[model samples]
Target: MPPGVPLSPPPPSALANPESLTRRSHRFQPKSIWPVAILAMFVMLAIVGIKAYRSLSQNPAQSEQTVEQEARLPVRVTRAETGLAQKWVFDDGIVWPVKRRVLTFQAEGDIQAIAKINGRDLRAGDVVTKGQVLATIDSRRQRSAIDTANADVEVAVQQRNQAQATVVQAQASLDRAKSDLELAKTELVRYQELFDQGVISESDRDVYLNQVDQAEAALRSAEQDVRSAEDGVRSAEAQITAAQARVTETNVDLEDTQLVAPIDGVVAYINIREGEYWDAQRLNSGSDQDLIESAPIILVNPQDIEVEIEIQADEANEIDPGQLTYVVLEEDVSAAQAAGASNQDLLEIAQDNGSRGTVFSVSPTQTPGSRGTQVSIRGFSSAQNLR
Candidate 1:
């Protein structure tokens, strides 16, 4: 064939199949096939988008719920040796110190400075021993008072010495007057004897008698002076005693300036500070009219602490003294703090920190207006920080 001539149509064997014809026609019309492909793609994308939207909206809530479940505390379980369920009753109670001391000013005065322990100033939450000096008041005036009392005592001693000397002098003077009186009496008796025997005149005898009376009067005056002197000595002694008493009292007041801890305890509170006046009137004695949280200072014994349990009156009767009791705390703790996480397969998370104790005391009678009986248990975990 010439190079310019067109080729003739191919034979029918190759194009005999309708499928092959269809394929060729389809290739020629690519735009028509594109629209169908795009529509199918749109349908598939719509399905996928609906599923994805639903998944995004619902997955967060489910994840949040799963996290909450993980953080939730597990319940505590108590078992009996018999593997049988035991009925246990719960109650509300308070844990407190066994014996707490309400520290107060034994003597009223202005606060000076809190006593330092190992150079650390004493304050609330400080541990103290018995008879430890906790604080000091303004004792300058008290020292002055003690000095004045001492001076008073010295003056009294001097006065007493003077009184004793006066008594001795008075006694000496009385002795001399007595000697003169005896002499006068002897002379008067001799004169009377002479008058009776006619040895002397009557006038002479009468003069001698008058001399005896004068001597007796002088003796009486001396005796009275001695009595007065003795009385003065007694008065001086009394003054000395009174002065000594004052001195003792002043010394006591001076000691009062130092606040001492009466027992071994931790200082729970301090309602006063240095240089501040502690008003004793705020202290609560035996009276229903007023109640105080604490005294100017307070002490709590950390070694001894107890929990008071309250339960229904009927239930209290069911529990005997020395019977074991388990107290469940109202609060919860994290799983990390739990005692044994393995045995707690029944429940997960917050296991009970229940304290083990025994019933030691039963109330003699129900408290007035109380809904239950009060019982005391001695052994439990002591919580020092009440606040």
Candidate 2:
């Protein structure tokens, strides 16, 4: 009567009755070639045959009934799954420039003048390029020194010229004296010849010889004067060289007066105002006190920024380079915490609005006078991100 109940095949004697088979077909003529009873019997036969084969193939210890009972047993179910892991670190930090420098003077002087660019006086917050002068030191003294040196060099050059002229005059005098000496010798020889022929007195011969001696003495004096003149020329030349060296030094000092920007950046500070002296000696005290006394006169930096974070040592250990980070303002974080936001909620909020960064570096040791380790986070500024 049930849809899936099993039935058996008919005996061979029932199949042998051809007239009975025809009667069965006619009994369900509206259904099909076979009567409903015979069709039911065929379906039942297929089911029974499959069960018989299953029973034969099954192990003796594992019956069909036992397998069915085990499958029917109830199981206590629960939901369980795995998902991606993430860790969030919450902290506060101060913002900083990604790259920056503090400008200081090497040579000390009074801040006499500051550079002007395109008719504008350079000051803090002004953008500058490499080699662009920032400010000028007092160079009035240097200029004066240079002038004095130039005058000294000119005087030396004049003296050298005068000594050279003196040498020339001495040489001319020496030449005249040589000619006189030759004439005197010739006269003396003539006198000696006349004396031999009794044509002149011995006193006349003595006069010519005395004249020759005077001419020779004058020649020696002229030669000595020439050497002295040459020495004067050389001394003057040496003085000129010394004066020229002084001029070079003054020029270098003048160049140092102009404080040029070493790199392209904004002028973040100017410690010395006009007329303020930057003492080179203050830096030599070998103490921290001098650091402020001789600190940089200017500070400069790029637009990219960073933040320094102080986090618990345990949490800091988990952090590594390239790990994702977010920097929310300290005030904002405090406010969020005061409002009772959950850590998860706070993280979600920061992720949405805070600047994205990464763990750029982590301090190997804890910060001085601080228990927590310091971490450096670098990120693009909000303004840059908008672009």
Candidate 3:
């Protein structure tokens, strides 16, 4: 009976608020949320599975890569082969050539000419051969003197020839005089025999005797002429000899005007140039060192370059002729100075600078007043940094 009365109509409030009814309906059916939760759970599981699969897929390669990287250590490698083992000795030294010469003019004059190379005037560092005429002073005066001497010699020679002709003429006259004297004597003797036999008169015999006397006088005169001619010839010969000597002297003077190189070498220094005056007496007046320093030309054999070093006796003992050597450069010297250099450092410096050489000579004994010895290193001049 009550349900039949309630069934009159649904309430307006309940009808107006449909959301409440829906909420009420949802409250009674809680099982509906499980499908969405299950879907979300499945989505999360898929994400987890994808991540796990990716991690599993990359781990083996990464692990292998890491293992490979960790297995190796950084190192350098080189081929094993036989080679020369070098021992280095460190030192500071002075470099010079073994064969050096200082050349100067022997006569005083203005320089008229100088050697040339590559179309340029000869300068320091130019190579030259033995007997090269490096320069020549003005030789006009010497040439003039030589010309005068030659003229004198020619004149003297002519005099000698004239004197020789005169001697020949005198000899011919002497021969004729001898024949005349012999004829006169024979005639005189024949005339005397005739007179003794009373076949000739006294006057004829007397005339023949007189002829003989005259002939003797002529012979004496001819002999004197011959002697005078010989004397004149001798005088002419002496004058010729003296004139020739003068010619020789002038030739030597002319030669003195030129500067010649005595050996094959490079020009180390040149003080004279064309048109400059050179004075032998003045240039040669200074001490040897000064002379060398101021000499007109200086030459050095590049292949015979040498370096002189003063090192401790103990250090020098390790060096000998034919041992390898090297030169420390200025830059290397600075670095060495900063680091208190060792032999190894010096070796590295020399190798980098390319100044390689060999020991040429070592003093046999220590220096007189110190425990040091002198050592010489030989190298080519092309080793630019060797000094």
Clash count, predicted structure 2? 0
Question: What is candidate 3's lDDT per residue for 318-371, written digit by digit as tens?
Answer: 777987766766666677768897656666676777567787889998877656
Per residue, candidate 2 scores C-alpha lDDT tens digits across 257-373 of 777777778876555677788766644334323443455445457567777778999988898988777666556667888899777777776776678778899999986666889
Provide the clashing-pair count of each candidate structure: 1, 0, 0
Report lDDT per candidate: 0.73, 0.75, 0.82
What is the lDDT for 63 in model 1?
76
- Top-scoring candidate (lDDT): 3
Candidate 1 accuracy as lDDT: 0.73
How many Å off is the CA of 95 in candidate 3?
3.9
Misplaced by over 4 Å in model 1 are 1-99, 106-109, 281-294, 308-387
For residues 1-387, what per-residue lDDT tens digits would candidate 1 score against the true structure? 556755444357744887776667746432334457779999999999999888777878797997799879777889856342323565767665677766666576778788776787777788889998777777888789889888888888888888889889989989988998899899998999999999999999999889889888988988998999888888888888988898899888877777778888888766667888876786776521222254667777867666687778998878778876555554432333354434243122212345556777988688666677888876654232322
Scored against the true structure, residue 250 in model 3 reaches a CA lDDT of 98
TM-score of each: 0.59, 0.49, 0.58
Poorest lDDT segment (10 consecutive residues) of candidate 1? 343-352
What TM value does model 2 have? 0.49
lDDT of 2 at 278: 74
Q: Model 3 scores what on Cα lDDT?
A: 0.82
**Best of the two (1, 2) by lDDT:** 2
Judged by whole-model lDDT over C-alpha atoms, candidate 2 comes out at 0.75
